[model samples]
Target: MFPKSLFPIALLSIISLGSVSAVDYSETYVGCVPIGTGTSGALYSPSVYIIEDCNFACADAGYTYAYFSNPASSFCSCKNTGPAPGDISSVASGNTNCGSFQATVNALATDYSFQSCYNSPASDDTTSQSTFDSCFERCSTYTNALVAPAGTTYTCLCSNTTPSGTAESCGYDGTFFAYSHTAISSPSLVDRRRRRLERMKRDEQLRLNRFCPGGLQACIVPGSDDSFECIDTSSELESCGGCLYGSYTNSTAPAGVDCSILRGAAFGGATCANGRCEISACREGFQLVDGKCQ
Candidate 1:
């Protein structure tokens, strides 16, 4: 029998392992149909052959459609919709399939270029381009507007269909270019990835808030979310004040002054008093002035 204390660890391991499975591509096909390949939404490497791989690539690119040519020597194209303008026979049709993968579960498409067809009166409209993600996230709750303005920081509008404005190159301007997944055909695949990322973020936050294990103090390195070090703040000279505090070696005290300097041979004794460095006693012939040996 497994020990009771080991149950949580075992369960966490199971969940972690389950989240690493391949993207689900079942039920995404629209039958073997002919499609024009004149303007592909996005082109992928020729090495890809599996339909599931193409599905995921399209999802990542924030496109609703995917095209597979010559399944034997796979080539993938991602797009918003099919029936593009071109010669139908430009490519062989025996092993080609062009279709949109409707997510089986509710999922948001990220980095997609949205065209707002129309919007309700209460819908949010903003000129701040930085708020594009927030606007896109908001669209997920309502059904009317799935499309939001992209690549222009000046406006954020959502609508049911593609808006009538000129299509801007996504990520070109300093506007909200990346999109959040709102609706997709493959619910299971999109939702799974979203949930996994959310879980990882939550785990990281919890870890950051907790105390360091094994009697160690937590230290956060600048410019990193996942990098944390544990140290003994009381005795460690470098981490004298606390985590992320200035180093004692550099003469920059953490949040408080370092009393350890008074413990040297020049001073008899020192202590941290009320978050300040103080000298308890002075060495022979040395007088204490303002908590320092003079």
Candidate 2:
């Protein structure tokens, strides 16, 4: 990308397709106009132009190319392929020509609603070159967002919430360019994960509603058949805390439970602590192992 200012006299010689003839061009003149400054009241830079000539034959290619001899910078050349001249008449007058490339430059500056390069803001002029250098260096390594050219700043774009929980924002800043939030992953995967989590949560809710209704919370401890750790608010009985093995048997127990102690007690008492029951010596004897209280 060459500076648009080099269009007028800088020559463009295009090699026509399948032809030995060369189309040579040269800008003979250059000029500029003043554009306004920033809200901070800085002086804006002036526009530039080039005046030139075509020494060789022109082509029907409908493209105008210009190259600035200055190789010190990146944007030192310009080229454009526009509609071909309607007739030789326009070609002779340079009507479909690039003598006015300053027009594009002007448009670019105005497109962003900024001052021209020459009519820079007073604040911009007052800033030390070191500050600009630092800003420019910082802008180059940035990729989390778009980086503007050396002089501009970053701006934010508008955002709308998608059906998904993420938000998107984008905009152009003089220094940094635009920032947008996009899905780094495939939408299907994100959607799938969301659905899976929701389903698990729903199932857990349903289980709670059916069995633990109106009681202090309970959980279905993983890895069992309908196995759950529930609390009996009414009695604090080992039966409520312990896994229900069908009316009296100890089946599922919360972690650290001693279901064997629950025996035949009308109320699960001293035996149950923290969801587990402790077996007493008398209850142990009642087991009648070996056909005796032994």
**Residue-by-residue lDDT tens digits, candidate 1, 190-220:** 5675665465345433433344554455555
Each model's RMSD to truth, in Å? 14.9, 30.4
lDDT of each: 0.39, 0.26
After superposition of all CA atoms, the RMSD between model 1 and the true structure is 14.9
**Number of the predicted model whose TM-score against the real structure is largest:** 1
Candidate 1, residue 262: Cα displacement in angstroms equals 8.2
TM-score of each: 0.32, 0.19
Candidate 2 ranges beyond 4 A from true positions:
1-199, 216-235, 238-269, 279-294
Worst 10 contiguous positions by lDDT, candidate 2: 83-92
